[model samples]
Target: LRKSELKGLEIPGKLERLIATFFADDTTVYLSENDDFNDLQKILDDWCLASGAKFNIGKTEIIPIGSPEYRDLLRQTRFLNSVDGPKIPEHIRIAQEGDAIRSLGALIGNNICQVEPWTKVLERIDQSLDQWARSKPTMEGRRLIISMIVGGMTQYLTKVQGMPKEVEEKLTRRIKRFLWDEKTHVRINKETV
Candidate 1:
């Protein structure tokens, strides 16, 4: 009927310090509008035990869960890079030949000039997308689509410019894989009611 903190436990003290880094043990009081005493008490007990912190049963109360008033707060919160799309620099937002070549090299786990042409191809794709976007707003989707289109064009340009055959072959294989992934997707259309 009364809350109690487990005392005389040194091991638990050390554990509490360690877990506190990852979990919170803050006091949050709630009062239930409905008679869900059984469920609420069980929840309090479970959380108290699991968290290695004593729940002040005397002070604990369950309230009806309601939505936060500031519903749009989440939209303005700053988030980590992982939460944001593609971990690339802002300057390279559009794929440039230099960026593409770097990405191609990155893909094949290579550096140096092995995939320079591929990088140039990526740069062209980026430039082309920018041009298309400026000319037609609806063509925004063409950004990714043009990458595949220009991959072939840039590869041809690279050949005319006389890139190494081995490098060419490697870039071709890498771009093919990239295009295959982008072009090949499952389309699920909804049946009308």
Candidate 2:
């Protein structure tokens, strides 16, 4: 509601000009308190089309206006607001953890260290790491571990099969879940598909 908070709104076109000229001094600029998602989305889309700025689709979220989860999620990540564009899932397209896990999978398969499928995967991983570094860089000692959840099938195929009983037992102990956690990335099994 504050003047500084206006920077977060996605009011596009002449509406933005109107806001700046007349309501710039006003704390609250409301059209209708009962605006629906489609209505708000229309306003946002118009704003983005008029403005040259690109919205970071990976960093945006849409939540029920009054829900506690909405507020909590927003509070946790500031970029969740001001998302007035198309949504892109972060795991496949943006998350560094996804890239890291994919690279490790290649390494385990002995596909890395050479230039095959690993080359493409490595290139993507390099880009993801570079982006993450640019956003929130840290030294090795201070970096946080990104947990990339794997499916039971991938685990069974990668870690269980073709391994000694002792090693398989050790790996089973390390995995906390039997099911895969879903994300935006795709899991490929070349032999099957």
Candidate 3:
């Protein structure tokens, strides 16, 4: 509940002390090496016991964040990586670099500009286009369809996290090609719907 000064946690290149993120039943706790995991788990277990909810250790993971070199160091020292290192709970594994962890609906990994995050949305867009391809809707109908596709950026799946420029262009090209029923998607110019 209280934000304590995050000490001994050398995760981010630039840090923001300690913080806990809660989304409904799921909880993410950020801590440093100096923190006592046993005590923390006990508190969480107590909370879970009182709340009639079970702590799902199977879904728990240790996500290492920082510069690549710093993350490597954290990985090297992980209890899994080093038997002599501090022991972690069974079923909990440290995430490797470039691993995409699906939190809520977002695919998050080490790279911020990665296209992976938009893969699902792109799939949905493609499906919509495929379904609409057979229809002989008017030009205005195509424009509305394109508008819905664009609106996905603000939708819950994406949540306004801007995608890579390449992805934006890919979406534009595909939708435009579908609008004009053209074979070469890239050939659809901006002036043509």
The candidate scoring highest on TM-score is 3
Residues 56-113, candidate 2: write the lDDT tens digits. Answer: 5443333212245544443344233423332322331322211222322333221122
Global lDDT of each candidate: 0.39, 0.34, 0.67
Tell me which of candidates 1 and 3 scores higher on TM-score.
3
Q: What is candidate 1's lDDT per residue for 1-193, written digit by digit as tens?
A: 1132312113444543111111254443222222233444476688778888786554322111223321122122211111443222222222112222222123211122544555656556555555554654333344355555655556555544456677556555544444333345535443620
Q: Over 4 Å off in model 3, which ranges? A: 1-18, 79-86, 157-161, 183-193
lDDT of 1: 0.39
Q: Please list the residue runs of candidate 2 whose C-alpha ends up more than 4 Å from where it truly belongs after superposition.
A: 1-33, 63-193
Per-candidate TM equals 0.21, 0.19, 0.76
Report the alpha-carbon TM-score of model 3 versus the true structure.
0.76
On lDDT, the candidate that comes out on top is 3
